[model samples]
Target: STRMRFGRGAASPAGVLRAIASGGGTDAFRLDGVDHRDDAGRLEVLATEDLAVEQIGYADVVVLSRADACSPEALRRAEERVAVQNGAAAIASAARGEMRGPSTLEALLGLRRADFVQTTPAKATHHHAYESVSLTLDGEVDGERFADFVETEVARFSGRLLRTKGILAVAGLEQRMIVQGVADLVEITFGEPWGDAKRTSRVAIVGFGLDVGSLERAFTTCAAS
Candidate 1:
């Protein structure tokens, strides 16, 4: 596992990118409560400014620090917003830098090219240039139908869609399915069983100039009939 951290008062985006280029490893960004401020004064770990938002897009994993101080609603909103900015990035919430287990650290440090394939190397650019959308579906879905939907989506969206990943409940399968797509290439494989976890589908799509509503509706229709 490889890891690098950027302090709260680190250099600018250009400097960070330069460091990353030289460092030659996976990058993870930790956002804290002090960095985020909303209408309710300062919501710890729930709000972020331009710099943090931009970093989220470039990171392989994003950890929301000081989450214990934030309200449940605030944390939910923050997760939702972060999901839309970098759908492929693994997200987790921590309190005082303490996470559940080593798995969280592994998830943050693990760099899989197949999981997050970038169309273009990250550089200092406008934050709003790209967008990410996350979708959640309950119940099982038809495997073939889901595959067809992903194929069509990648074809239609083409280059604009940087990456897409999901944990799906495929009909007639005891184990969960992990789907990952980079541009036009997509892969689906079986993961662990549902076990005690809730059976649901969660997906994240990252790209530029996406019609999120249309994509969401199209994905919904792919559910098992």
Candidate 2:
């Protein structure tokens, strides 16, 4: 977790500071539509629009209140801008936790997690495919072979493929490993040991403009034995 400051207008920040100083758990740093006045009774305002991501990135805490983190469209724009400019900034969404859309799957696929998030149907510019399959075999796998399988299967349906993530078991390793692939980039890491819950490998593939049947077949045939 990163420490960062929040930027708000007028009494909103002061109110938030007051709440925090008083040991009250306030939801956000908003003035609730009230006119903001400073200690001298003059309007207190910050240059929010003029502040660049670089400035917001330096605060140990950031605040958002009310409609700040509301809709999916807003969330998307905020995420894109923050990602490109504020790699080290932390965010505080004051609009409550009502926004929902992105999931662990999307995060894994996108290669990063977003705080204020929402989801809508993907655009038509690209093909997308998604499928979940379970592997019954409990044998150890050759890492190279597994990697090759993932790459080739994804490529076979590349026209529509966007992302794929799964956990696999190798014949010798007691613990399973994780695999994440996005377009042409793929990564693998050691994960927790297979639990008793299912003891099977699960895979989900998402592709753009790709046929689901073809994507499924690609994985089914990937093992190099």
Candidate 3:
């Protein structure tokens, strides 16, 4: 599992990293408030609570990006603020466009398995920023059908959909599948074996102005018939 990173500015701190971490099927476990970012590069007016607000005090790690855009003083000030806000969070800074290359991305998300583990629970705030729907299915699902379902939803949601991710229990594969998406982009790969974890498939869709009832119904049909 790659180390999940949350963007700054309007996007709340990565309270959702714990969920991604636990999805790795490791022996570790912890639940966190999810704050999936809205569409990348999209700007919007935020409420007072959504602006420069530190809702949680115990974030595991915080990645400071766009270092090239800020001077030494500005960067230092941002770091200082993070320290004051999430004192326990490990601070990592990245130069502009540093995350563009595939190799660079691998390094960022390839953090140690333990880094993703959270010791305390954080609640997700700022509901106005985005909406999310979680779906879990028992037994195996048809991989092809699941892919089709994702494609259909992404298209239907269009500019409103932000991301989709979770573990899947495929019809015949004992190894769990990791599903991830950003906008219309989606990918699936083999992960650790089911091991002692339940043989259940779970996924989540984060978007803006979603038709929850229709999405939930469409996703359920991905099950093997």
Candidate 4:
């Protein structure tokens, strides 16, 4: 990540190289070392910026640490990377205790229509369907089956997924429900219909990680009416 660049006012390459060679990790990148008056007066570790964030884009695992808020530029750059990586990275704050504490599935109980934020891959795309729909898996869909379907879909689209959300109408459940996922995490919830009228039981699956044609096909072909 280290790179050589002439400072704004200074033209001596020898001095910059000498400082870089002698400076420790902390001293190597310091605001004081770089002339504060001008923005481009110090050597920077480009890879440290790259290494600052890590992204995980798979089912069965969603690990987000607290190192995303390094700086506005850093976080902004990291987010851009996340969107491009297509759901490989989860939105996180590098500052400790800055979030609403650690995440727990407790909030997902009876949840429906979840919205996702950002990721490490910055440019991750998303999918949406406005019409009401339902899912009819043969018998019941185990966690493994659902994960497999999602993984296949992610790969098929090369990781363009940001968030997935929709209502799931189960054959046996008393009330309509919701299911959602961000990055690698997924959840299902139960809830009453939004309106007094009974909502059409439908499954709406959205994707940002890849072309949802396959997902749409899968749901349409397999879901129960």
The prediction achieving the highest TM-score against the true structure is: 1
RMSD of each: 10.0, 16.9, 14.7, 15.9
Candidate 1 residue pairs that clash: 33-45
- Tens-place lDDT per residue, model 1, 30-124, is 21111221222142232245655545554545666667777878777666555556767755666765753335444444322223322222222
Which lDDT value does model 3 have at 22? 38
**Residue-pair clash count for candidate 2:** 28
lDDT of 4: 0.35
When summed lDDT is taken over every stretch of 10 residues in candidate 3, the lowest stretch is 38-47
TM-score of decoy 1: 0.57
Candidate 2 lDDT by residue in tens digits, 111-182: 322221222222222111222222323334566666666666566665343344456666566676665544
**What TM-score does candidate 2 get on C-alpha atoms?**
0.38
Sliding window of 10 residues with minimal summed lDDT for model 2: 34-43
List, residue by residue over 1-225, the lDDT tens digit for candidate 4.
999987534242224433443454566463111111111111122212322112122111222233433555655554443333323212333245333333444332211233233222232222221111123343333344444555665336433332344454444455546555443344566666444444443333323333334555655443444
| Model 3 lDDT per residue over 110-160, tens place | 321111211121123453444546667887789899878877765688765
Count steric clashes of candidate 1: 1
lDDT of 2: 0.38
At residue 7, give the lDDT of candidate 1: 82
Evaluate all candidate structures by whole-model CA lDDT and list the values in order: 0.59, 0.38, 0.52, 0.35
Instruction: Give the Å error, residue 196, model 2.
Output: 4.0
Clashes (candidate 3):
1
Q: Rank the candidates by lDDT, best first.
A: 1, 3, 2, 4
**Residue 4 local lDDT, model 1:** 93
